[model samples]
Target: MTVTLAQAINRGIHDAMEADDRVLMFGEDVGKLGGVFRVTDTLQETFGTDRVYDTPLAESGIIGTAIGLAMYGFRPVAEMQFDGFAYPAFEQFTSHLAKMRNRSRGRVKLPVTVRIPFGGGIGAVEHHSESPETYWAHTAGLKVVSPGTVADGYAMTRAAIAADDPVIVLEPKRRYWMKDDLELPVTTEPLHKAVVRRPGTDVTVVAYGPMLKTAMEAADAAEEEGWSLEVVDLRSLSPIDTDTLVASLQRTGRMVVVHEAAQSLGPAAEIAARMQQEAFYHLEAPILRATGYDTPYPPAMLEEFWLPDVDRILDRVEEALDY
Candidate 1:
């Protein structure tokens, strides 16, 4: 079926709810309004108010209550509306939802899925376009995963809901409208594994979510310059697919990490360090990063300069190739 990425997510939610009685969802405008992106469109109608519904305009309250529901043996999928809006629930998520299992010595489990629309290129106002996945990924005990394509968008959501622990789904808002003709009932793949988007040998580029398309585009452009760039999509940000990444780096001998988030301490830094540790002897050049500047996310007008594009990614690849 040909469907938009957001519609695939909606189907994922429907399948999850149908497959598990414990599965339920709540978030701002998710019910009657079908979410700000319409990703939850008609979900409440299909699942009913008890299973799929809306919550008050409180991020903290929504997450805090969802945590309680999870601890009580329910699988709750709580939407944060936007990446920037999710910060208000940080205390509830990190302090309790993320720590409850460890704190209880395995006596309690938090089977929760937090769906957050993240990243830029949507020309959205402030608070709607930040890539805050790093914060959640850095926090211990939470599984952070992002999907780069329509197939992944469907599979990862089911995987996230099935996880016994907390999982954060950082949906790329800009890619929501992208279309794909995927077979229905797509089998779920390992949520923590990375996949090669394009196979090459001259260099390896690692990216996920909003940046994966950019990385692939850069690889396409690099081919014309006689550089074969392999692209790895780091699907799981927390427990990164080091094995896949190392294998790719071993083949290419050079790596370039790309993301829309600021460069300092971002996922790119961690990926670079891991490649250094695992593929140190094979590295032909230092792992370079093409990322957003250290400053706050620029206004929509200047986002073109702020976010990484094919040219920026190619520049980093050139540096690595030259080395």
Candidate 2:
């Protein structure tokens, strides 16, 4: 079946709720509105108000409620509505959502999933377009995962809901409309395992979420230039699949990391550090990063320049190959 990324997420949530009565969803405008992107369409009508409902426009309150519900043994999937909007709930996320199990000495497990629509390229106004994955990925006790394809969106969402610890699902807003032909309830790799999207022998291009598509395009273009670019999608960001990444690097002998987030202390930096430590001997060049500038997300018109695109990614690949 052909399904868009948004539809895949909706079906994933619907299936999870149907399978587990404890899996409940609540967030701003998620009920009747079906989310800003309509990703939750038809869920409320199917499950009624109790299982699927709406909440006030309070990110902190939404996350707080999810934590409380999770403690009560309910697998709560909370939505932040947009990327920047999640900032209001940072305190709740870092202090409570990410530390509950440790604080309780492993007795209390918070099976909470916070679904955040993140990244740019839709040309929305301020606060609507942002990539805040690094914030959650940097926090301990929090599992951060993002899906680049329809299959992973479904499988990863189910995985997040079933997890004993809290998980942050960063949906690439730009890729929401991207479609693929695949049956429902499809399970791909594990939540934290990185998959090689395109195999190559020259350089490895690592990306996740919105940037995955861009990296793939770069790989195709690189082929015309006689460079084989292996693309690896980092499905799980927090507990990164270093094994997969190291294996790819060992094969390619060069690497370039890409993301929509700022370059400073971003996921790319962490991956580069790990690759150096684990597979330094196999590296042909210093791992380079093609990412957003170390500045705030620019206005809608300037986003094309701000976000990492195919040209920028290929530039990094060329530089890595030169080394």
Candidate 3:
């Protein structure tokens, strides 16, 4: 029950593979290398090479093959080597996999999951730490989900594998090693529900994936400064859990959306618009967003200034409280 975020994800994938004979996993370095982070190690030995294997250095081929496999009644889980690498597969995803269900008039479904390691931290090189969840979420037929905790990572993988639609699982690469104390039997929730990570009446800090940890840290730091900050992990990014967030905003009267993606038309923009439409009268100040710079993720040295951290989140929280 007590596992690091990375182990939880690995265990989740193993569970899905064991439960379904039709489930297959393929990605660069996945079979022999066990993934660049060792998340898929030992899978090929356990599941057989046919079920777990590696692909060439082509993102489009990975996705295109996965789509074909899904059409043949297999649930394919394809991993994009890095956030930037997924760009080449966008056509296959948005044009083919994402539209299959709708294009088939709901007669056929593409039960495939695309796993992309995204977001910055750990002093990563360029493209390895890019946050590109917004791009996938923008696709209509794709269901986008990001895990903010070990339990979410485990449960959502199972849920996504079972769904009858294409799903994009965005793993926060930076939080892969962040250890935590998990409960036995696993604290589980719906795949589309937002989790109230920290409860307070003052203000709500909404984040998913990597930014949830920062928001929680900011909440802890804010407590020391006598500000009770509520942190909500927006688990489902595309079909966002607006009902849960609307309740939080009504109670807190202020909201801050935090993410590592650029500020424009990102998840924050969608959440802010939802909040403004649903809880306009309850808000004490305009919904705020604490996110990465509009520019690309900088080098290891400058990424510190670009990514949203505890200090930056707290600064925005204070500004919202003042307003």
lDDT of each: 0.92, 0.93, 0.89
lDDT of 1 at 315: 92
- Assess the local accuracy of residue 233 in candidate 2 as a C-alpha lDDT between 0 and 100: 96
| Tens-digit lDDT string for candidate 2 (231-309) | 9999999899999999999999999999999999999999999999999899999999999999999999999999999
lDDT of 3 by residue, 85-143 (tens): 89999899889988988988998888999888888887987778888888888899999
Q: Write the per-residue lDDT of candidate 1 for residues 1-323, one digit (tens) a residue.
A: 89988999998998999999999999999998999999999999988999888888999999999989987889999999999999899999899988989999999999999999999998888878898878998899899999999989999999999999899999999999999887877864599999998999999999999889889888889889999999999999988989999999999999999999999999999998888998899999999999999999989999999999999999999999888
Count of clashes, each model? 0, 0, 0
What's model 2's overall lDDT? 0.93
Q: What's the candidate order when arranged by decreasing TM-score?
A: 2, 1, 3
Indicate the TM-score of model 1.
Answer: 0.99
User: What does candidate 1 score in Cα RMSD to the true structure?
Assistant: 0.8
Q: Model 2: residues >4 Å from true position, as ranges?
A: none
Residue 319 of model 2 has an lDDT of: 92
| Estimated TM-score for each candidate | 0.99, 0.99, 0.98
List candidate 1 stretches off by more than 4 Å: none
